[model samples]
Target: MPAMDTVVPPEGTILTERRGTLLLIGINRPAKRNGFTPRMYKELAEAYTLLDDDPDLRAGVLHAHGPHFTAGLDLPAMAPLMQRGEKAIPPGSVEPTDLGTPGYRRRGKPLVCAVQGITFTLGIELMLAADCVVAADDCRFSQLEVKRGIMATGGATLRMAERAGLGSALLYLLTGDEFGSAEALRLNFVQKVVPAGEQLAEAIRIAERIAAQAPLAVVATRLNALKAVEEGPLRAMGEFLAVQQRLSSSEDAAEGVRSFVEKRAARFTGR
Candidate 1:
């Protein structure tokens, strides 16, 4: 984490703060079990946009204010909007789901998520979209949209199989079976499992580690890996030499070499 910078507090269903180069976005609708009402969905997408567009923000952490990360989308509130064929977000804004389509823009920056208690449906998709996830031991996860007579409209169907394999993804996703944090780890849904109350801190620590690295390299690394996953190995492999040459020519690369010879810490300026 960069040094704490006092940021003007955000007032909405989503709470955002700028701390150094990291953006902390928290779900604030705890009273309603942090459900994604249409308002909350739009606010979160705006926060994601801020993280992507602001050069100062290198990464982001998504957590919740209450005991649980979320109980999933407030279907009654969101169904009407979906029925009307309207996006909850305004025009020219990034959609939170990051589902590749004509209007939805993919996010370039990295995001880490922390979860505990009940995390269902959209909550699972949010984690699937994030770069990493820290799950508390108390978490109880489920994909309950099927039970509600709907299906996951987020990235779950597309990405879950990538992480957990097709059989495992269908095992729970099709059955709406609830699983614990340990199971989440075994399924590769979450990277780390911490005790209750430590999830957000663990996610912040991981984000801080990401922020301390060379910014351009970090972004390129993420993009390249995403390309391998989304596009294919051949597509990502074709650009390897080009990307390496570009990074080697950067000022940060020179500083990295100099710091190694001097036996000191490298100070990266995101150059």
Candidate 2:
């Protein structure tokens, strides 16, 4: 892992650092269990925007500074913002949750998350938005917005069911009960579960592996999978064929074939 001093987040709420082609974004308010303040939301959005815009950044890993991934939203502070219909990304920032203003969307690049201890409401939603997730064996997750007398507006209602199935999602979301990492894994909400202290390291390993692949191929794969989820499979299939045809003629594709025949590692320039 790169030292934390490499890149400092403009808003002190989040920490940003570059580890080779991977961007590490850590929720920095550990004293509050990394709870999301309004400022933190904007900081996170900015981080996602940077990851998407930077061609050199191939992947991103999101983790927290303390024992917990997050305790979820700071309801006392967020209630007013919600009531006033305030945007979370601020002006000129990409929306990480894809819930900002009309036409705002999540970044095209892939994101991986590491979760531990308490992960509630928006925390779970954030993981759902990520392409891959690593959770500590002791981690606890909940979508408790119903208990708070509010609905989950951070894409949980739409995403949780897609990940955990309709019956399981309602069993947890409707009751606001907590689930463990084992359950999360069974529900396909997370890709890996490790020992408590090893979650971040495992997540970083996964991100590094992703970053080593041909960047254009990785991005196209992510986009194709996302399209299958957002649009119907039939439409996504058509789009996938078109993308494959276009990518097959790229320099990276030629390099990949040449490297395979030569029995050497490929050095792709993402063309």
Candidate 3:
């Protein structure tokens, strides 16, 4: 494992580190159940931007340090912003880019998230941005913005339909209802549900497994999958191999061959 770099944010809200090839981002406001202040969002955005440029990072896992994964947005802090008429991005103001991070392009790397306890509104939105999600067995999920007389402004409004299908997404969004982990899993909103305390560890394990794979091939696979939806299935096959061919010369690819011939587990350097 490489030496991991730690990043600590003010207000003790964000904890970041590179664990092997897995970039772990922890929302650390346990007192308020990991609720987001505007500052937290800004910090998270900055972290994502930094991760986008890191060549050493092969995969990422979003996590929280607390009993509850998140209680969603801090209404007390955010009420004033809403009152001031500040809002999420205006419709069609710009094309959807990089999971709707204001002006940034998409980071092609795969992201996984571990969720537990009170997931609501923005908490659910966070999952929409992740490529895969794992929830604690007792976790709760909801999109309660409708109860507050507002609509989801995050990617959930768009991604949810594709992620969970129109019926399931609409039921939760329109009624502002909450569901438990079993329901979430059955509905395809979460990939796996582990015991309550094991979410982060399981997520990290998955990320590390992904990190051990061919980095370029992983990105290419994700791209082709997404492209098959937005572009076309016919184009995806060709695009997939074209990318895999380019990755054949990468250092990690060479290490994979050497390790196989040496009859030992491959120690990927993530080159």
lDDT, candidates in the order shown: 0.87, 0.86, 0.76
> What C-alpha root-mean-square deviation, in Å, does candidate 3 show against the real structure?
4.6
TM agreement with the true structure for every prediction:
0.93, 0.93, 0.84
Please state the error at residue 91 of candidate 3 in Å. Answer: 17
List model 3 lDDT by residue over 150-257, tens digit each: 888767777778777898889888999889999988877789999998888888888888888877768877888988865678877767566777777788789889
Model 2 TM-score on a 0 to 1 scale: 0.93
- Which of the two, 2 or 3, has more TM-score? 2
lDDT, candidate 1, equals 0.87
Per-residue alpha-carbon lDDT of model 1 for 207-252, expressed as tens digits? 9999888888998999899999999999999999999999999998
Q: What global local distance difference test value does model 3 have? A: 0.76
* Candidate 1: pairs in clash: 1-208
Model 1 vs truth, CA RMSD? 3.4
Which of the numbered candidates is closest to the native, going by highest lDDT? 1
Shift in Å, residue 210, candidate 3: 0.8
lDDT of 2 by residue, 158-258 (tens): 88898878998899989999999999999999999999999989999999888888888898888788778878788779886779898898999999999
Q: In candidate 1, where is summed lDDT lowest over 10 consecutive residues? A: 1-10
